[model samples]
Target: MPDSLPPPTPGEELIKRIAVRVREARKSRGLPRRVLSELSGVSPRYLAQLEAGEGNISVILLQRVAGALDLKIDALLAENMPLDRDAERMAQVFSKASPDIQQQVRALLFAHSQTELRAGRICLIGLRGAGKSTLGKLAGEVLGLPFIELNKEIEAALDMPIAEVLALYGQEGYRELEAEALERVSATHDRMILAAAGGIVAEKTTYVRLLQRFHTIWLHTSPAEYMQRVRAQGDERPMEGNPAAMTQLKTLLDTRTPLYERADSQVNTSNRPVKASLKDLLRIIEKRRFLDVLDG
Candidate 1:
């Protein structure tokens, strides 16, 4: 097995960390889970599930977790604590993330530093026609990081077109190829622009592993705009004989939205000019100070 494979029960560890923080906050506030739920407008059962680490929470629920404890949301999700003298400063940084994410981040830093690097890697994801390649290249140039398209790499690794590879090898084979491509990318340069495959986020283990290696940005596009762009790019087959193309596109977008939102930052790419969109994305990255966050 590869060294990068995330160990079993990662979700459980995350849940445990969340539960621990929730428990601590509840006690500190002198409130029971029911009372916390009432104040936060979250259900007691959900809150209990959250406290028990059995829930996969949304950003909103995470905020509610903080609110219920009178703690800031950031504090609840931060990956590390500061030193004794910097304890107060660290506490002000954000909520504590699960130990696993913290460890993952540390492992990433350690692994990456062993390689010497540049401006940190940035990952772009979302549906096709979201301008991940275009904007990712531009953003990478601006930030002085190398640009890499994972799909292109995957194709190169398989020595064939993606469609041909998929058709010949099947979905399972393609996933293995994808994993190998990702592993090769991860082992290479530490700082780069990653224009990732759109559906990578759908695979939990793969997504978490990649997250350990790159700061992710979700570039969102509306289905209408995506369809138009794909058509304009000469891939009109989706629109040709398939009357259900539009419906399927809409459903796919809806399904991926929540998953995409889990990204470090989100930029809606529909309608905006590419240049304008890249600038907005750059500002978002700077605002988040991902470089500093990653360094920590």
Candidate 2:
């Protein structure tokens, strides 16, 4: 008879849990190993070892894998609990803190989880064709705050077209540039209106940071209205004669709705004039004192 395999050490058991979580998440999403490897910049062999619970990974590597998996590390390490949005965000913040700080934060969150975090900076978040740029500019003018488009900032910082950034650096590279641009702009301007790239919510770390550092507003619009606006602007790149374009757009909106919903407030532009929408957004800012208020 073959000898029984020795029990896994405690640390090995933890590693096994993580590996199982990673493999299950990838498989559940029907993502092939090569796809995950490509998305994560991790080798297929390394991912294989990870799935088999035979390889030790560094924190940075684990973070890369988790981000590519569209999961928080805490979820990967969760103790048999199904992950939810609140759990994911909590884990994102908790995992980034020191042990002592984590304890303090736990108590604080328990005591006042409902407390709002409103920063002085105004950040607009939404999908494309939702009037983030147009509304953001108008709001900035009205509020006397400088207007910044994060995409333009990323382009200037990289000194190239965004298409080139995607070609050269990939999605991860673009996210790095996006975060850096946000920091540079936030550092330079004490109070400004920032129109973030539509997909910024997909970057967990950056999105969480934005939540902590800005008064975010989701610019909501109907899928039909969104398509109409996109066409009105002469940008049909998304459709390009695809009959299922609206379906695709709705899918994206549905997937990202939860993330966008995390904003401090929402201003719907559907069935409303741009001026009216801007006025509604301005009132939100006034209520929060987001504009013209410097951080202490």
Per-residue alpha-carbon lDDT of model 2 for 61-126, expressed as tens digits? 888888887786767776775444456667678778754465346336534432233345789999
TM-score of 1: 0.60
Task: Report lDDT per candidate.
Answer: 0.76, 0.82
TM-score, candidate number 2: 0.59
Backbone clashes in model 2: 0
lDDT per residue as tens, model 1, 136-253: 8898888887889988998887688999998999887777777777777776666678998888888787887677667788998878898988788899887898999999989998
Name the candidate that leads on TM-score.
Answer: 1
Give the Å shift of residue 213 in candidate 1. Answer: 1.7
Residue pairs in clash, model 2: none
Reference-based TM-score of each model: 0.60, 0.59
